[model samples]
Target chain A: MDPSRLTIAQASAAIAQGSLAPLSLVDSYLERIASLDGELHSYVLVLAEEARERARALAAEPSRGPLHGIPLSLKDIYWTRGRRTTAGSRLCLDFVPAEDAETWRRLEAAGAILLGKNETHEFAIGGPDFTLPFPPARNPWNTAHYPAGSSSGSAVAVAAGLTAGALGSDTGGSIRGPAAFNGIAGLKPTYGRVSRRGVFPLSYTLDHCGPLTRTVEDCALLLQAIAGHDPLDPASADRPVPDYRKALERRLDGMAIGVIRHFHEADAVAGFGPENAPNPAYCAAFEEACRTLEKAGARLVDLRLSPLLDYADANRLIMLAEAFALHETDFQERPQGFGRYAFARIGLGAFFSAADYVEALRARRELCREFREATEGVDAVVSANATAPAPKIDTVPLWGVFERASYTAPYNLLGAPALSLPIGFEDGLPLAFQIAGKPFAESSVFKVGYAFEQATPFHRERPPIAASLPGRT
Target chain B: MAEPIPPDRFTVLVERAGLKLTPEEFEELREGSRFVERMKESVRRSGPREARLRGVTRPREKTAEPAHIFIAGKD
Candidate 1:
């Protein structure tokens, strides 16, 4: 059996049934990483020896849970005790954390083996920067293309089959954007759903830690292991986490799904430019995805709230204000320590006044209220995740993020659960759409995403890099 | 429409932010300020017109509060 190709659920089941040994699965991924990651640049550090030791140790014990023996990577921003956690900046090349991030500690206790640390955009806010200590992760579909970041390596690792799953933090569209570009399943759980303690902060109010996996079901399994409140995280939700996997069986029949077509077809384009319009192929794929959901007995409703730019601007302002505050000392003491992208992007925060930050906070409240009221009658809302497939890496301008209105940022502002799953392909690259639910309504989002995933083959399709492997072909 | 921060003004802000940048980095950030101006414009345009018109001195509806709130001593 090829353990490298199995999803987290399948590998867990195999390990539980005694068909797949934990060591073999870990070895499978390590070997794949050795063969592929040189060009992909997905991992900043590969824990081959540590992973093998852990796998052997787990092999001696009975199954711990569904994630038992599963190998996964984490974005470098997540602190792993005694492991170098570089947040992709040269400033912390040798910095090591004294303790594990709450999320990583939970994953470890659940019997999942850590394979490595994935690369991230510097401080999780920078663009793909060449000046960083590590090279930016390239898309698996085509090396020359961009892998939407700062969870760039997490999505690349999963999509390239280097790891069964990865944990990533999302502020704005970090998780969902890369997931869309890589054609994997990425979830940005409702704010405070997962503990962020020990993970480097981008924006205190907007950051969320979640899973990136090959399929929606795998995403659920990973989320189950990580979700819940952590007292250490002041913002962690105190609510109980539902059985996300079992909830996946819930049908989409008779569910009300809001389709925000204007987000991509009009608002984003009007705000950016004609070049920012979603590709025709992407539009067709989104239409087909809507049809697939409708066929699954979901009722599609056209919904509109605040313009996309409103949410985008608010999200950006808050993120910048908070991020700069956190990194101000670094920016001042050693401005040259930062990569060019991180330096310039975070520097923009200094231009905004104290009143601007407070205004953004107020705007956030209004946008959230508007979203909740508009989505009151709907179980979930669907929209384009990325308007186009990954573009040439160099073509992306340093200020490109500011130039476009993100379809994913509205959910970030609302602190809602949003999932990005593959819908189709455009020009051999992946195309994806997002399904967002009310705050803490990940189950509804999963139900809608799973329904569409099962009806389409997009999730099952592997990137060319994965397919080109000798036996995989 | 919002105009980008003037170069002299941008230089002062950058200096006040305590970031010492190369001329190249400064120029890049100066160019990037246009987007910041545009974003500031959008944010200024958001929220209730009554609040903005009153210059934010008027009391807002009781239930309308900032998204992030702090309750001192509450955990």
Candidate 2:
């Protein structure tokens, strides 16, 4: 495989064996980023010299870890010491943190090379705002379509082979949305599984840090390097960090899979896409994914919980309330610093009374309890991540987030582990389904995601834009 | 959905929030309030009414220090 196309594990193995030097790997990616990122807009800032210097240093040393010599991009929200962390907003264009985000520190310790800062939805809740200092990431599958965000650039980088894997934070499906849209694997680990210290806050209670990568195993590898307790992060889980890559070795045989069929089927509000009718492709792909699991020795059971709208409502209220709290002063003082979509979305928070915010929290507990009770019989729940493939970028409305009920939001609200993996495609764009597990049961989520990845050939199909890149063998 | 917050009340809330939205922006927000109203209704419907009442009716325990700050997935 071309160096850029190689999974983290494959590249690590090659690098460890000295067949591929870290410098060469970084160079290959930099070359590809140079060639593709102009069109893809996957990176906001390219730290070419820093990346090359880090790669050269790694090339001289023995492997520090599985992530040693690997090149990765951080969503611009992750504070990198002395590097501009724009959080995809013009307001923070000059902002640079003196310390690295805990995840960034951990990855750097694992010998990962910094590729650049990937673009994001402003403050992770903004729209695909073109008015921001940086352009929104273009979907590598089809440049004209929306790469579901706010981890837009992170997914684009991985899908287009601009970076090996990228760190993406999910407040409400940001990581998984882009992963699904771009045809890659995205894992939003159980809340607090990865520390959020030094990452710009989106929703303090709801935000989750995770990864987007080319494969389930790669996702596990990236998570392994980043997941740990940080004393500075109040929500950081102090539980023992499991060997995620080793956990991937386990088979999915005999695992009980709960299929949340109604979320996407009946409740999903199709927003921008031309297809208002039920997406037959998505329906067929989801059914095929279930069959793939069954063939892999997993038992599929139909499971229903609270209506998707209920979860969406609770999640939106909490996120908006919390995000507004975080940026309230700024929103008041200089609302012009924010993009129109971000301002409009965050502005909704102004109307929510303290009673409303508290009520949402109470409702959150109820919904989470329901989900927990519903999933007790099953190891994980499978559902469509997005209603369809990427929509036209311009077609996404400013109110789209409020207008739709997400398959991914329930997991966000539950603070559970959810993985979005490509199942198939429609109109040459990827379609995905999420495997959600109980809080802290990322092992189960990865097991199911890996089994599905192995049984299907969807992961093997690269975006045509990437395949057509000159000099790619 | 809960009845739309009257424009006068909405204006007060925006002023308290210190946001300076133009009339055009406020009009757009007025339109968007329908979504928020629907969401508020859903949350209210879903909330545990008894829990809220109990929270208000039975507030006794007072601690000098905050509750334990254990993280999720940890003891």
Candidate 3:
């Protein structure tokens, strides 16, 4: 069997049954990365030797758990002790952390082997720019197209089967955007659900550390290991993590899912012409997904809150203000140390006055309350993740992030759990939708996502580029 | 719509923020400020009622709290 293609659940089960050796599984992935990553640019660093060493050790010992010996990569924003953890910027090229990020520490204790570090947008807020220390990861579906970022490489790696799973940070659609573009599963757990201790900060209140995987079940497995309270992280939630895997087995019977249609159909398409509206394929797929959910005994309820632009505005203003506060010293000391995208994007923070920051915060509270009330009648909400498939890499505008309202940003503003999974394909690229739930209601979100995933074949499809690899066929 | 920040005022904000940008960079950022201005206007506008009723306005409650709250000695 080709171990690289196996999901985390399948691989762990094989290992538990003594049918697969951890060393063999790690070797399979290392070989795939060595062959495919040269073109994909998914990994900034590949810990081949370290991964093999851990796999060998695990092969000789008793299995630790479901993730024991599973190879996973982390977005570079995560701190890895003694390893070069460049947040895809020249400024951090030589910087190494003395201690591992809390997430990394937890995953290590759970028997996960580190495959390497995936690339990220600079500081996790910038757009994909070639001038950064590392080349931005390319979409495996079509390398000429962009892989929406800042968790660009994490999603690319998972979708390409270079890594079974990866941990990515989401401040404003960073995780979900790339996941939507790359045809994978990404979960932005409720804010503070996963500890950010030792992870590089973007927007302190908005930053969420979560998993990107090929399947929703793999996302659950990865989240189970790193979730829970961390005393060191001031924002960490001190709540018990439920059995996310167990929750997935429950069908969507009697579940009421809110469909926020205006987010994509009206508000997002308002100013932009027909060419800029959500792809016809995406709209059709969204309707099909709603039908599928209904057939599974879920009740689809139309819901509306504030306009998508309102959430986008608040999320952006707050993120820029907080990010600027964190990097003010650097901007002042060595303004040229940053990439053009990072400098330009983060510099916008300077324009926001202290009053603007506070006002944005107040608006965020109201928006969150509005979302809670709107979603109160539903078990979860479903909406578009990316309005369209991946665009041409060179065609992306520098300020494109601000040019459109984001469907994923609404959940970020509300601090709710959101899962992005493939819903369909268009022009050989992926189209995805998000299932979001109330704060700390990750299990319900996962239940809806898992049910839809099991009912569809989208998640099982792989990129043609990956399938064309020398050993893949 | 909010007016753009005047060049002199923009310069003052940049200097106050301690950012030293090349002329070209400064020009680009100055142009980019329109997006920020738009966001500022969106947030400064009155709450949900104003969104639904464009001409209607209401005073924000004094007791409405920001999303973040201070917890003493948690660390």
* Stronger candidate by lDDT (1 vs 2): 1
Q: How many times do residue backbones clash in model 2?
A: 0
User: In terms of TM-score, how similar is model 2 to the real structure?
Assistant: 0.93
In model 1 chain A, where is the ten-residue run with the lowest total lDDT?
A464-473
Q: Residue-wise lDDT of candidate 2 within A98-188, one digit each (tens)?
A: 9999999999999999999998899998878888878888998899999989999999999988999999999889999999999999999
Deviation in Å, model 1, residue A148 alpha carbon? 1.0
| Candidate achieving higher DockQ, 1 or 2 | 1
- Per-residue alpha-carbon lDDT of model 3 for A1-473, expressed as tens digits? 78888999999999999999999888888888988899999999999999999999998988889999899999999999999988888889998999999999999999999999999999997768988878889999999999999999999999998998999999999999999999999999999899999999999999999999988899999999999999889888899999999889537888999999988888775532245588788899999999999988899999987767778888999999999999999999988889988999899998898888888888899988888888888999999888789999888888888886688888888999999999999999999999999999999988999999999999999997666346543
Against the unseen true structure, what C-alpha lDDT does each candidate score?
A: 0.89, 0.84, 0.89
Candidate 1 C-alpha lDDT tens digits along A1-473: 67898989899999999999999999889989999999999999999999999999999998899989999999999999999999999898989999999999999999999999999999998879987889999999999999999999999999999999999989999999999999999999999899999999999999999999999999999899999989989999899999988778535877999999888877776666677888889899999999999999999999977667768888999999889999999988888889989988988887888877887788788878778888999999998899788999988889888886688888888999999999999889999999999999999999998988888999999987886357642
Best by TM-score: 3
User: Best to worst by lDDT, what's the order?
Assistant: 1, 3, 2
Pairs of colliding residues, candidate 1: none
**What does DockQ give for each predicted structure?**
0.47, 0.29, 0.69
- Candidate order by decreasing TM-score: 3, 1, 2
Q: Report per-prediction Cα RMSD to one decimal.
A: 2.7, 4.5, 1.6
